[model samples]
Target: MQQGSGSLVELLLSADNFYELVSTIQYLDVIQSRNSEAVSELVSLTDELALTQASLNAQMDEAEAEKQRADEARDEAEEARDQLEAKIAAQAAAEAAARKAAIEAAQRAAELAAQSEQQTPTFTTESGNDATVEVPDLPDPDIVVPDSDKDAFVSEWSARIDAYLAGSPLAGQGTTFAEAAWEYGCDPRLSPAISTVESSTGRVCFLPHNAWGWGSSSWSSWEEAIWAHVAGLAAGYGGQLTYAGAQKYCPPNADAWYASVLANMLSI
Candidate 1:
């Protein structure tokens, strides 16, 4: 009883009380360790969240960059399309203008041709003699020819022959040809047409103005040649074309010469 009555501070200092105090301290330390582990876990979770946010930001940046590239590509494509359309429009406009110009030119040309047809220009004979002949209007096909118009007819024939041989050596011999034809009762076109066939209208022949290719013959002048040939045709072949006459004239190539001469005569 005296021991139990001892001081309470001494009782607390005893081994059993001390063991209980140590146990309580250990439990408090365990609780603090668990709290520290929880704090570390929270820190790790926060770090992971931060990493995930960073990754999401990077993905968003990449997506935005891709969108910018796509937009640029679309803009470029639109620009190209617009350019192509503009070029096509320009080409179409050019073709339309060309067509319009051609139509206008054709209309103008037709108008000019009509005007020219309405106006009959005078043709003056440039043969040896200068004669101003009035170009008659379209003649009446039913009009009968009077004997008095013979000289006028011959003059017209002369003009036609002269025009036909405008650039030839026998150009100015139309009047001579007509006179010779009248004198010999020969076709006016015969001698000259023969000359055209044989010598290209006296351009090439066997010598000095020998246009008719008449038998190794040469003449002093075109007039001498013309008279001689016309007289020969009148005397030799009756101033007419026949196959027999052609054979007599050019024995070697009669058929060819005859056909060619007939064709030339038709042209005249």
Candidate 2:
């Protein structure tokens, strides 16, 4: 393949933008072989020069052999030293380049791994309400009535439906309304059941784990919603709010009423 830019060595040697240097090292071995051939060629050239000097000496007499030997020795030593030094320098440069490339690749890998960890989102849930941790699907976006709100239960449930569809942040802000309702002496089940009564099968504003239409219930931020339900009931659910003497004010089926209100709280 054609190299897009500089020499293979230059591209492979860069520390910050290097890859494939190891594979290219084998190519260096080939270059070393070529360097060896260069040494052979230089030796042959020296021999040819010596033969020329010897031929020139054939035109002279006596101590000519000694003179030629001395001159040839000096040239041979200098030339051999130059070639050895140049070969060593080239090898050292290539090795340094390869090592720098490897180190940069490793550092890049580490940086990418760190970035991956930072990018991944971590889910979080408030404490004490395990249901929030494993909430199922969110309910439908809108809950419509069955062409009427004439029934007493339907009308009462309808009021809370507005709050649920509003996606009130009070409960989701931190507190499970159940704890709030329980603390304020209102049945926790009442909220979720209001949702069911208004929007059966989670069709109306199907929020998950929020039966009370509160989305999330917490007394800390949603003290008003909690107190509202309490005060609303205290104003007299069917003329009297007190739980005592409940038999007189409540319909004949008190157990069934709370059941239909917050079915999820039936176990509670």
| Clash number by candidate, in order | 0, 14
Looking at candidate 2, the ten consecutive residues that score lowest on lDDT are: 127-136
Q: Which candidate is the best by lDDT?
A: 1
Model 2 per-residue lDDT tens digits across residues 152-204: 43344334433443453332322333343434444433444343433331333
Worst 10-residue lDDT window for candidate 1 reads 122-131
Q: Considering every candidate listed, which one attains the maximal TM-score?
A: 1
